[model samples]
Target: MIKPSSYCNEDDGEFKKEWKNDSNSSSVNSSTLSLHIAAYENSSNSDMASTADTEGLKGKHSLAKKWKNAKHPFFGSSSVIQNSFEFTRQQENDKVSQSEIMQFKASQKLLNPNSSVNHQPGEKNMCLFTLLRCSDLVMQKQRNPEKKKHLLVKKLAKEGYNDIYSNEPTKFIYLGNAGFVCGVSPTYLQELFGKLDGFHKLHSFRHKSYAFVEFKTVEDGKRAYELYDFPAIEAAPKAILPKGLSVISEFITPEYEEELLGFLNENNEDMKNRSVLHFGHKFDYDSNSAFQKGLDIPPILDELIKSMQPHFGTHFPDQITVNRYRPGQSIPMHVDTHSAFEEPIISLSLQSSINLDYTHCANPTVNTEISLPRRSLLIMKGESRYCWRHGIRPRASDVGEDGELVPREERYSITFRKIRTKPCECPYIEYCDWNRNGVTAIPSNNESARQVEKTYVQQVYEDIAEHFSQTRHSKWNAVANFLDSLSKGSVVLDAGCGNGKYLSTKTDKFFMGFDTCHNLLRVANTKGEVMNGSLFEIPIRDSVCDAVICIAVIHHFSTVERRKAAIAEITRVLTSGGKALITVWSIDQKTDGQMSAYAKMRSNKEPTEMKQENNAKLMIHDGTDFSHCDMLVPWQRSSDGAQFFRYYHLFYKDELDALVESFDELTVIDSAYEQGNFIVIFQKK
Candidate 1:
């Protein structure tokens, strides 16, 4: 440390007077007293320069009187270093004159010699120890010390660094894949690291989870690396991944994932639209020859496209293939044909979390697996997309980041790609089959297409539970009033009580609800008892419920036989005199005008109409045959600048009544149209 030359003569006298008056000064060491004197001398000149009467005092009372009673800038009452800087504020709020100020100035001089220094108000004159002091506060929080310490222990344990408080300097640890689990707090880490010799500062990575324990000298890092390299207890999980593969944990929020799922569900039918090359012009795997007009990017997916602008740069993706996966379902191992799509393909996952297997196309033995969390966005480009044939194994569940085998839930992924019009211009020319030499591959059959549709029905609703729960907060007055009419102590059965929004209102009755989607049931179970069961085959026995209400569930069946079976099941569950209510979306609703307006906006024939409030119309679709009375309607959920969709079937007014009439065990009590739904009350005969 460098020594200072001089202090203001008047300041020394005042400091001495205050120091002698203090009773605690007797306990202070000689070194601390010397430091106080040095600090007062160095900062005295700067403080005196800022006074309002510097010139007046110098002319009248001379130098000694000018410095007397000017200000106790260094200390609050010239007692100790802690009371001055840490406890109380000095007269000059702008400048914090402390013992550390002398050392900071000396360090500055040593680093940059022969430099002129000026200490003024509102200037960047903060000492180096300011950060250290700030960090110390975290370790010594005033309130609820036990609770804070427990939280700190839990956080450190999650990162596999539970001994952080004890084994800090010896172990320079950084967290990986800290999606939900808390890690060592920044302030705590800083405080611990600041105690190390030759410590500079801590540096966090682009991803918030990762950080570096930086030191001023290379020797410190080497020593730390050697000591903590193979500790008895590992600090962080070992990441053994294939080359060019990465997992970004929690890339998107749960609410945002729900919105994306809702948007996709609403616009799912557009994937079958004529403009899309993949849908209209089928790929013949055998010949490897196909028209390259490319798939048309749907206008509904513009929000996702815009969100990906920062990554793709000038090249906007021209194709989006949304795939919904059910439990035990996985994609085959195959490279995205080089000529079909450009480099840097991105896939945004929503709903369920799963593991992806990446195997080298050339070297089949070289493969690795990466666990993907829900709402993670994966970017596959160059070697990862081309050289590797990435796929997922067929499994109902996968290991999570926490190392537990978690059961797989329904999942949806939106894969975005820039369609490559031309053929074969990659490093793996031998594997390039875009310009095929007469090699033929069989096309997918109709059964495969039906399987995909079946999966969509099961997976879409399951994946959007969290997001769908958010919107289902408002209970329909019509349904709530109907539940209110029921007598107290009546056992009520809600067939598809999503999130149990109405169950809360019927507290007087013992209400039990069930749905096919377990994820949705998870949300509903919080409010009331909910079971995982289908409408056609309810887990409950016959004549058990006092009343059964199957709301918006009858139309889900595509066939008349299945729809009739669902009605019979509900009737079977109710007593002879018990009342049952059923509701379904109606085709009688006049949404044709809105549908035409949406088609026009989608076609860009009338771009100005895009701003129109036709969200309901945009989602409804009428089947080609009105006689079948089977049409698909979509529900849109938008959140955080993204959208998702879920599909439902609407029933014609007469068709719903006819199905209910066919149930021989039930008699129609009342029928009415309320809130775009055909609601009918039936009494068990």
Candidate 2:
């Protein structure tokens, strides 16, 4: 409970005159009254100095006047001021008696209109406790202004004052006695409030005993306010990880991580484009188990496993699976097949941190997310290994403990297990495949590739259509110049023309645009004649257009065959000798020691070099040099901090020319690197 003071500001001369008149008529002893007055006058100069530091000289004078003019209920006018001054003096000397303290408490109750305690009418109060407390708060304000504001807001809130305010729809709710000073941590608050609907973030003032919980909507805030039980929040534990599951952070050094990554890059060159690699035995995803044993584990990996044997005691792991994840890639929730592997599965994470979600097999609603930092080790056995299903959500970023977005980077994981000779006898029988006699097949290679495009490329563009359109308004100068060079009344096709930005580039030419995303087509429809269609199967007749432009579109295809088909479609719609301009994201984003515009948009922090492997389809962060030809790039929406990953098959120098040259009917007219993209102009024969 908080007791806030209310004081009236008045002129210094008038206040002094009123105080003098009231003091002469008071029944207090003359000696005691003189001592109190003298002590107050002595302390006033120092108190004013402290106030002047934060509020300036003018504010100090105003506060001084308010202190002198404040009235008391039981002791008549200005008597509370004298008693507060006396209380301050007594506190400094540490000589105040129990009876005097009791009288101060009674005065506080009388001053607080909201206090439930009843008091007799006309009871003589010897002190003004609120004024004394407010004076002390003023002293605290000089040291920390933010803390003072927090305390003041909390005090006002406790007294039933209206603190919620916003010009837009309200999404923030105030919580009293729910901050660091009240033994409530931000993580603790997040755990409690995050369970509610639409909860976004929690902001806690450490020095102030209060917090503001932000939700996704005003209704969410109102609902949370009604449902949240503040009294029980303090009693909850800090964290509750799954039983028999443990994470050891920084289990390996930076040097060791580099060494392990180097070994994987060198040995697994043939399978670099694939996300998963296996040694000792190949994992069969369809069956959710491992088979085809006798594959040799590299010498370095074997040494690493041997080093970890001390932690495992007697049971040593024999098989290893290495998984590489792009920013938005994810593994579906599952328990390792019981009959295929023994207990105590271990995994090591490298290069980036990620959240692993665990859910009870019996209850879908019971789930928790835990972070596995880079270079960490995770070991699972018993209930955690059998009864809990673990998985990672497909996202480019995760919400941090402090309620902020933490961007993701490329990550690598090494998992170790021993083949089981007998059936599993674990206590958790409900999830055991041995008891259930269940088997599942793996998806085909082509279907898996298509799924990547569907999730990372097609779905991403559709979700971020509005925001993407906003950022892509400016047309490229080269593209605009090419459109201007076209003959007047020439029929033109803008394949994959997102938002139809280039359709109106040449008003004299007849332009038609087409895109795969309906949301983008809707935006484009407002600009010019646009239709919803895919680049692979353009809805146009052969030789119908005089010119065709496929700007920044071909790279979205996951495979070289699909990219070739897109190029063929563009050629099929062009007339003889018709020109086409194609641009793809370039592997080299820097020229002559200067970074391109795309790289410049990234943070100024020093970029980390990615170790190269054979055509690896890795995740690439902005501003970093490309280590793989095919990669996933992240696009973050500013409005809600939602991140989407876009797949790109970047081209190296001479690669686009080589691709166009493969078609004898097409002749490359000009080629150059511009603005982090490879630009190639070709004409149909």
Candidate 3:
């Protein structure tokens, strides 16, 4: 009978001595490895057969029953089938040899049960369970000692037992209710838990609900199981699990975490389209299949993956995804397509910790939330990797087991996967990409609104973005010279920056640009940091930019206040000593001959009337007609029969200078006419 104790404090040396004596009873060769343990604690043969049948392992179970009458204590223990299962590597020769050793040991122990042996008064020693499923095949191989290994391999593959040949299994022990200790420092927990003899590595996942601790040996694991009784923390109520010595804790130094965080920050860039960069085979949404794109994985990433081989096995990841999330951002719930990638996906987190929600596709109500800590590596395999869908919720702060957990900074993650070479034969075919039978994709409402906004002004540029880019290839000499004069590493902002024409000018410094047109921004993205946004409202930190350039943009405003507002916005974003270059279309640039006809076309209303205010004249285009300062400029696409009109407020040289200087905080540095435009450089007070 097995004695269940509250604390089993046997030391490592005692266990080692017992194991050596037990192992001495048999000297088995690698050939007889495919042995099965046929005994159970309380289950009858019929009960075991029912279980095997339910699991679709009928053949394996029947083979094991054939050895039930064998007189070996090692072959009849309940632990053999439960705690003693060993994970075999995919290496073919080693797998066969190891399988044979299991059988040889079991046979030797059965034949010599009366040999001199030492046992803990009443405790049963457990033996590792071998490939019980391959017993029948091993018997045949034994009969014909000269049988080739290839034949056995072919038989095993045909029987659907190949999945067991997984990569070197990761050593992990799951901790229940880790969320109760979110306030506790990981380093403190690690130190407290490290007191247990064999604890080597420790990690905790999202919301601190659970954690995994690795040990050096099986004896250490059993010792932890018996001695470390988890106690409930102060945060948990009666409903929470009681904890005396919980199996949750581990240490990661602050210096190590900071190094990883710095790496991610250095590589991050503002993205306007997809939140992540997909490398290797790109998954096509339209066709619902993966296509091989000739992009190679970065060498640095390859080195990082290689460094993780000890923990995650020797699986080469072909697909890599890099994602950066700021505050109030999130990734929607979705599962990796079964047909697209292999099992055991790894995600490395950096900078900020976050909670991840996991749900079963078949039963959505049964959900699990895991907290991912900074600089931690998360491995998803087996049931967690295949059957569930995982995602992060959109929120600035997450409510943990105790209270809210607010990230002090941004978060980034790199997800790595090995693309499957062949068709997927996974059991969850119903939820796979091949059919999407049970899967439902939910479109983002926020993204839909953004798409609609893009159609207003963005679609116009999208129609002629490439052609317009061609006409403006050469940079304006004066603006180019000013940009070149700036010191290296000076932050620059391109307000209403389209196609990123001047982006490459600042090489050493960070250059950021924004536009309402997504199509134009896509082209600009190749040169610098460009995002989809509006000029009237800048999406950046206050007073952070060293300089700003708003060219051929202010003239597009319909009202004088709007134009003034645009200038004020630029001033607000500039540093104290920062300067800005503002330009508008010049009415003087047009020939006098065309002025009469244009005047007639715009003869509907009077020119803008204004009054002096705040030491400078207020430039108001209120009640102005469609002619004079306001006119619609037409553009024709050479590729198609489409024509579009753009609004423009032509500014005289004096008027352009006065409008900019009207802001009390701005001091005009220079004003001039250059390249059919009125340009003015001003500094913020």
Candidate 4:
């Protein structure tokens, strides 16, 4: 009889070697068990199947009868009898594989025959049972190689297999036949596949027309294979063009385009580079405005406008600006000044094709790129003309939808517009230059304030979080000193804690920060505990924080009531006598004899005047002194050249003190002007 202790040896090599040596003995005490072990040991040899058919047929019959009556060692006695009988029936029906049957029989023989039949199996017996099940799964996988391995791993996990084996790295081969073709660059492949989860690295063999992608886990590789191994159904391109904008391709025949280009060539003074000619009005490129009237439109262009009258309906363009761009010349991204031009603006492209990009004025995420072929007419009106900035990038070649580079040549465009006789009254009030300067009162109610904050503050921060984080690495000395003064083991909260710059100042204290922008919170999460929440309604319980800090956050509120409520919420979360530090942009940038850092950073060049009357919000010019108490500050992203505007309500002297003093439960402890901010420290009563 085989010794149970020998079967339970920790080293699997010794146990298997002992079993193999014992199988060759003719004097083995358990003859029936020896036959099963020998059969399993030689199962991989081709001749073993024939040997079992010839010399082992009677033995197999006798063994099946014994297996039906014997108890299974792995499963407990309550179910082993039923399980063993069912397994014997499966063998007689040929439902189980020959190798699987041998493996099961060999494992059963290793158990001590003299032990109690109802005793529980040991850990080694359980391991043997797991091996038998795993071998059965391997046989099933070979029969159907396309079976998803993740499902097999999940089944194994349910059967008590080690979880580490399920997470082993898996290699996936992406055949080039599906959508992607051979000889496609690896850079392009990485761009397409790198977005999937668990992607480690990819190796391309262009000559063999396939690539190998190694995933961090088997499940990840199986998911990627299911998604990319087969030809995918093409999806319709999303509609990104702004409303009221349309492009007419091949708007004019080749002959008509030549006629229009002939007049422009004749009128073009400087042919080697960029040249411009304005008619009906002299366009001041610097001011983006039409000034004194200039020459009349050429007779050929006037005739073309007359022919195009039906498309314009009642708004006939009275001004024309003809621009000729040499091989690499292009226009900067800009919205035609709202005060300068009327609706239904049109541009006719001639000579060569070029690309035009449009970005929404308020939301940079809503954008599109267009290619204007030669002889195409680009029409803009309503939101497209008033709310989207259009420009052409300076490049010798343009990237097409397929990512191929299309070389460029000389191009000419004739822009036609009518000088504005009145302020724009379109529906896009937030983006309209006229409306921004008009007598639109400050948001009076909570709903109106929420709308203003949502579009100008919250949305802008979410879009510029990455670029904004790069510029905010330096913490203010006053704020850092306040954090350093905190007691050890104190619970601190940073409201509107953008990028969590101050969270790591003193690791001794428990720091938790929250922000309204998820993008900023994602960055903050790596530094400390951070959550997505609003300043107006902090999620923490009342009187939970020993100290609170609100930095340059209350100024984003559009109205006095909202700002005061934000302050109240901060105090509500503070413990009794707990101190809170708050800061806001001050209207008075210059204090005492020194200019604040904001004013010092202003460019030497003159800024365009955007002052408005009647308490209207002004558009703050880039790198300039503030001219209004409330304004829209512009932030342009460096990556895509998209601009987003954030709203700010600057605080005047003693303004923050009065706002904090209105709450009966708070007391102002200290106030000062640091940098360009109005800093105030207060305590909850």
Candidate 5:
């Protein structure tokens, strides 16, 4: 039997042994490689998926007859599918092969003599009834076999299935192929599919309620589970099953559930005009689909997923969609009913924050809201994904109930689920009036359906995150390089300084600073206890200085001519032979380099009013087409206009090298992490 609790627990203890490096399930693409910063190694979120024994949940019923001898013993859920049914034992899977999985998954019926004779004799269903340990965690399995077993079930009338859905005593099977297959042990069935939701179909012996349905394709099987999850109308005539309820919800109507499937089906008016980044499908970070815990995934994130597996009964390692939303961006309403695991979807929010909106699928006007704080997790099972749709409302500013306007920003969301359809664009676009009359009726015929899906997809987003980065450190290399340029006791000068955060850290005692601003000097002096004069002119003995070290303070100079003059003065004050360590933004095409200084001119917001260091531009024309003036900020020398600067600089390698060599003999580090900037270890002669 598939016991989630047991599997989750096992994963918990084995994480140390397994989850140190759970690599991406596929090749590390660009997007995946970019977002991985090396600074978060110590942080751990203890909720990773592990083994748990959930067999004790309220009502206990006999499993499908084929799995009669199956007991709820679990090898684990995250790294492997741990259900056993002695089969033909072909050389199927060496290390949990898919061939072996297919062996048990394809078994369609129980020939056990103790079977209930209600089954239509000789009736065959191509279904696979293998009990999978419950979990929606990513990367739970250890092996990656090429081939495996498969399951099959008869396809019934969509309408007829709906009619008999609530009252029929459908036969559950452990079938494989044709008339040839292995029958599953019953206890195993109960452990996997939630203890049978006690509903019956027409002619079903009111005594044997609820049925477990498994499709040959794991993907198809999960979607079928969600669509036909027809909850039993308890008070109606076919109420032979245990009340349908999960740890997450009471009972919700099918109509209510469909309304919640907004993400799956988006045709609302308010959602039409939103300029969001993406619309559909599942995503997760892995080299492949193996859920082996200790492989590539960091330990901290693994635990957080483990804590929620028990509630996700059968499907192990749910297909998860990992998304990143920068400031001023969001995802519209959508349903997750198409997931491959038929199990519930669980979302874990990390880094930064956002306001999440949940609304009725049928009525977009009525909505529920929650401020998804950082480090929080939300789970939607049973009716949550089917009955109630969820989305993120775009907001430029968010005011708390406390009336304090808190600054809002970009964030990362880890949405976990089992994928149903292959990742693709939304097809219903062109003919539909989503942007026109808003969800107005569009013909629902097949040809139109194809076009509807085609035109609507603006684009399918592919994530390109970083794989790794340097760890954090406190000291600066520039400090050592600066001291190296000095003699036994020569006065060293720091110039063009915004502040003296670097004053006291210089190696020898000859360090002093010059700044264009004084308020900055006050803050710096307090931190370091010393201050010199301005950079325009120096009070020290001319030609008596040994060295200087300038940090990221050059790009902000009034202009290139003025910056050159500033560097000239530093040289004028230097001894006949001395050096300097200069670090400035140097542009590089190797990475997302700095924008041209002009991109800012086009982005400047016209100022309604201006403050001390901030300016409002006068680029607006007072005529026609618009009103109230779309505000704009000034064109600062450096800074990414929108996504917030990962690093700020408009440096081109050649441009920076010329600027430095223009004054003295300076050597720029050929490969600085910041392409827009570089470190120049200079020696003045």
Candidate 6:
């Protein structure tokens, strides 16, 4: 009765009676194919329905939550491990036919030689099942040339065995307990299976329909993810994973050798020793026109060159480098280690997009090739950029006639780098100061990690229409909502005005703003005026405006004194009992709610310090104010919303009452809490 996707072995009989080979088995197979659905249905304590009208809790990622729960505990739970194996064996007994077990085990051994047993309960079932970076573990692999793989291939399908490389064929391997691991040759096993410390292979693929992969430790599973993402396969561009485990016979068409030969002859370099083709490579950063390769690079590529100037800052000394690719030529595994990457490498893909193989220098074993779509601007720094390297691999199909990875295709990328920066040092650096050096300043784990405190937090911003705004899109929403409730010609002023975001809202032409940052206001040019001003001192007439609105501004002040001064300004600017709609984090969440999580993390000896790349300081120092720190202090836990604040100011019912009583004129009318957000609407009486 076993339908095979359960991947449980035959001897153990993991499939249940009546359910074995049941029509429901196909549905279960389809369900297992989708890890998110499986996790949502199977996992306990997950909130499938949203009833609590928590303000920020609206649409969170359910898949992310599923991975955390499914992966973290099973490795430590012996009971879970035992239960998984027992479940597998029972399922095998119920459904999987005996004939499939032998081929499945052989395939398992070839892919991953290591196998062991578990007496533990509630064991992890799949990867993509657990790994955070990996969305799913149900990846299908191609067969090796010798037909040695014990694939779960459909029996009637045999299409393209003649075209596969005789030397190195495709083979599927096991990635811990719940996931599949694939390797090219015997040598790839180390890279594929070596990272899984606690995982043991379930060699007996009961159904041979799907393999049951188990992890001994969640860390092992994470490492597996760090190593074996489908994108990582792009690291070897020549090797493409076709869409799922389908019959290549049905999909693949025989290539005419003469056509391939003609294309090969056109290539300037000899192809004798090459294993794969590369479609992406920067032949010349300075090539303003096109290369001798004579690729018809898209005209829209002009925008990519222009975008670099903004992100690379003044440190970008030269025009960005550009590369174009056509089907069948791919760059191999290599590093673009140049001083140009002083900040980070920002690339924009246009026209022909490609797959980028990003691999860590420290963990060379870890790699992934995320797809770069046309017109997608990629901001890659730190681990995926400086600490590592990125390149593009070429293949035959850019997109199949059906519009998928066509085994090879044409692709192009524009990489804008900041070659000139405060001399920082990298391995390639000569003698220099912060301006002259580059990647070397970045602390390595081997190096004594220095505490890189932020003089000011660098908030990632976006420009909707000439006005700077948070890419998160929340601030704009908050501003628009505030403006809609107001009367026309209301002389409103945005205190702590960041880049005139509120002014960009479609409000009546009477909105003015004042900010601590003069540079931000210079371009604000609102209908009234945006002057350089602080909350402690308002340059405006008293009681001139009917309402004052503040959003995501008060959280920057770490201490209570700064908060009080800011509050006093709001009260002073208001007319007697004038309405003030403000959104500050609820402090109640920080005290009783957050303190425990922080204490728990610190108790585990969490590292106390961190570092950062200083692009442009978000907040300029007036030379007298306290320095700003990164959103999260090491060992201090704060949700994304609370990270900017001293603590989550989740106001308790009593706290709101106390504030209202103290102010006397201000009354809290309604409040709602969601996720990490607290929305309170106040009315002036």
Q: Write the per-residue lDDT of candidate 4 for residues 1-685, one digit (tens) a residue.
A: 1122322222223323333353345643332220000001112333322222111112112211111111111110000000010000011112333365446544432322123323121111111001011122332334321121222222222222212211122233222211123224455445444546566655443222234444545467657644532221222133467888998888888998888887777886653358988888988877788878889877888677986777687887778999988887877777887777877889999988898988665444456888788888999988788877788866778755443457989988999988888877666565555764433446777887887788888989999999999888887877887878778998999999999998888879999999999999999999999988898889999999999999999999988989988998998899998989999999777665345655554421223222234355444434445667888767779789776778889889999999999999889988988978999999998
Off by over 4 Å in 2: 1-448, 604-623
lDDT of 2 by residue, 1-685 (tens): 0111111121122222332343354553231222111001111244442332222111112333222211111111110121121111111112334365445434432222233333232211112111122233355545422223333333333322212221222345544445455554465455455546566655554344445555655567657644531121112132357889998889888998999988776655334333777888887877767877846887877677877787676887877899888787787777787779988889999898888988654333446778888999999988888867788877778654432347988899999988887887776543455633321111124565577678778899999999999988888877878888889999999999999998877778999999999999999998899988889899999998889888899888777777788889989999999999999988887665445677555422222221223233334333346656776676778678565667778888888888888998999998977888888999999
Comparing 1 with 5 on TM-score, the higher-scoring candidate is 1
Over all chains combined, what TM-score does candidate 3 have? 0.30
TM-score of each: 0.33, 0.40, 0.30, 0.44, 0.31, 0.35
lDDT for position 638 in model 4: 77
Tens-place lDDT digits, model 6, residues 1-685? 1123333344323322222333134333322211110011111112311111111111222211112111111121101000011111122223333455445444443322123434233321221222211211211122121111112111101111001111110112222323221111222222234224444433333223223333433345445534432221111232232111111121111232233334433543323323222222223424222122423333333443454456555553233444445566666444344343365556655444566665433233334546555555676544344344455544454432222333544444445554433334553221112333222232222221112111122221111212233232345344466568777777676776666666656546466777665445655664346787767687788777667776655554433455456666777787765656566544332232222222222221111111123432222111111123312221112223111212112333444334434666667765544323345556566
lDDT on C-alpha atoms for all candidate structures: 0.50, 0.61, 0.52, 0.61, 0.35, 0.36
- Of 1 and 6, the candidate ranking higher by lDDT: 1
**Candidate 3's error at 193, in angstroms?**
89
The model with the greatest TM-score is 4
Candidate 1 lDDT tens digits, 1-685:
0011111121223332332343134443321111100111112233322221211111112221111122222211111010011011123213323344444434432212223344232211111100000111222343221222222223322332212111112112232222111233444344344434444545432223334454434456435433322212212244366545555667766777777677666554433211112322344434333344535555556766787677676787766667777687777666776777776778877788888877654334345677777878788866787667777877767655544457987788777777677665776433455434312111133443233234435676776677778876665556777788889999999998877776667668999999888888888888888898888789999999999888777766545566677888888889878988888876544232122222222221111111212222212231111212332333344443122223345676666778878877778878887655788887888
Greater-lDDT candidate between 1 and 4: 4
Q: CA lDDT of 224 in candidate 6?
A: 52
Return whichever of 1 and 4 wins on TM-score.
4
TM-score of 6: 0.35
- Tally clashes: model 6: 88
Worst 10 residues of 1 by lDDT: 125-134
* Tens digits of lDDT, candidate 3, 1-685: 0011211112222322332343243542221221111211212234342222111122223312223222111122111121222212122222333355345434432212223333232122232222121233333445321121222222222221121221122223333223223333344335444545556655543332234455555456556543432221222221111111111112234675576456556654556533455667654543424566735776656556776565456668777777888776766566676677887777877677777777544334345666666766777776666656677866667644433335534777777788878877665432345433212111124443233234323566778887777766677876887788677878889998898988887677678899877778888999888887777798887899999998888887655666787888899999998989988877654332222222222321222112112111112222222235544354556678354444456786588788878999999998876645778988898
